[model samples]
Target: MFGGQVAEVLVNEVPEDVYLLDVREDDEWRTGHAPGAVHIPLGTLGERADEVPRDRRVYVICRSGGRSGQATMALNQAGWDAVNVAGGMQAWEHAAREMTADGEGEPRVL
Candidate 1:
C-alpha cells in the first residue's frame, strides 16, 4: 500500500462488522447507501470525526472512489482505523450489495 499503510479494500472484501462511513453529500446519502452505514458527509468529516469509531475498522465510501480516498487518508492521519471502499458506491451497487434509502421506497443510487 501507500507508504506502508493498508491498501483500500474492494466493497466485496469489507467485513460486515466494520463501521461503514458514507461520506457523500446530504442528498447523495439520502438517495441510497449501504445498509447500516453511518452518514457523515465528506465536507463535515473533520468536525464529526469523533462520531467515527476509532477502535473498529471504518470502511469509507463516496459516490465514486475520489472523496472516500481523501477521507480515508484523513481518518488514518487522525489515528482512526479507516479504509477506502475501492470504487465506492458505484462498485458496491455493481456488486449488488444491499442498499437502503433514508426512509422508504426504492433504493436508487444518485
Candidate 2:
C-alpha cells in the first residue's frame, strides 16, 4: 500500500521491535543480515508466513529489493502489514546499519 523506502531510513522509521524478515537464501543469511531479522526464504514464505507476527510492522529484505518486493505483495495479499526494504542488504550495508553473521565469526556481506 506504500512505496518502499531505502534500508538506511527504513531502519529508523520502524520501531526497535519491528519484524525484519530476510528473504535471502540460507548461504546469504549465514554470511550476514540485519540483526534480529527472521530468515525465511522467499520460496518458503507462503507456508511460513504465519510465523511472522501481526502485532508489529513487518519489513522484508533480500540481497536486493526484487525478492522482497515480491514478498511484500504476497504478504499484503495474505493480510500481513508488510513493506519492502528498498535496495535491501546492499543499502543496509551501504548505510552502515548493524549487520551480524551466524555467530561463529565476524559478519561479512556476501
Candidate 3:
C-alpha cells in the first residue's frame, strides 16, 4: 500500500479526464463539485466501494482534505489506486477549475 503522503495530490496536479470521486454530503454536492465527478458520500463508501473503478486511479475529494485522506488510505488498503485531493473543493475553486451545481446559478465551493 502507498503511504499517505504518496497518496495525496494538489488540485493543480490532478490530470485531465481522471476518475474524480466526491465524498461530500448531498447538500455539499448540490452546492458545487467538479464537472463529471462521481458522487459517493464518505459514509457510504464501504458499501459503494464496488462502484469505483478498479483499473484506473481514483481521485477522492471532500470539503477539505480530511475525509478524502481517510478514503485514500482505505481504498489503497482495499487495493484500489486512490489518491486524495489534498485541499478538496476549496482548493479546486481557488485553482479556477471547472465546477457545476445541481441546479440553477453558478457553482461555488461550500
Largest lDDT belongs to which candidate?
Answer: 3
Best candidate, TM-score-wise?
3
Prediction 3 TM-score vs. true = 0.94
- Candidate 1 has an lDDT of 0.86
CA RMSD per model (angstroms)? 2.2, 3.3, 2.3
lDDT of each: 0.86, 0.80, 0.91
Scored by lDDT, model 3 comes in at: 0.91
How many clashes does the backbone of model 2 have?
Answer: 0
**C-alpha TM-score for every candidate:** 0.90, 0.84, 0.94
Off by over 4 Å in 1: 1-6
How many angstroms is residue 36 displaced in model 1 relative to the true structure, after the best TM-score fit? 0.5
- Write model 1 residue lDDT over 1-110, tens digit each, in one string: 24545459888998786689999998888888988899999999999999998888889999878888889999988898888888889899999999889887877788
For lDDT, candidate 1 versus 2, the one ahead is: 1
Candidate 3 residue-wise lDDT, 1-110, digit = tens: 23535478889999989999999999999989999899999999999999999999999999898888988889988999998998899999999999999999899988
lDDT of 2 by residue, 15-87 (tens): 5657899999999999999888999999998898889998766888888778888888888777777888777
Worst 10 residues of 2 by lDDT: 1-10
Please rank every candidate by TM-score, starting with the best. Answer: 3, 1, 2
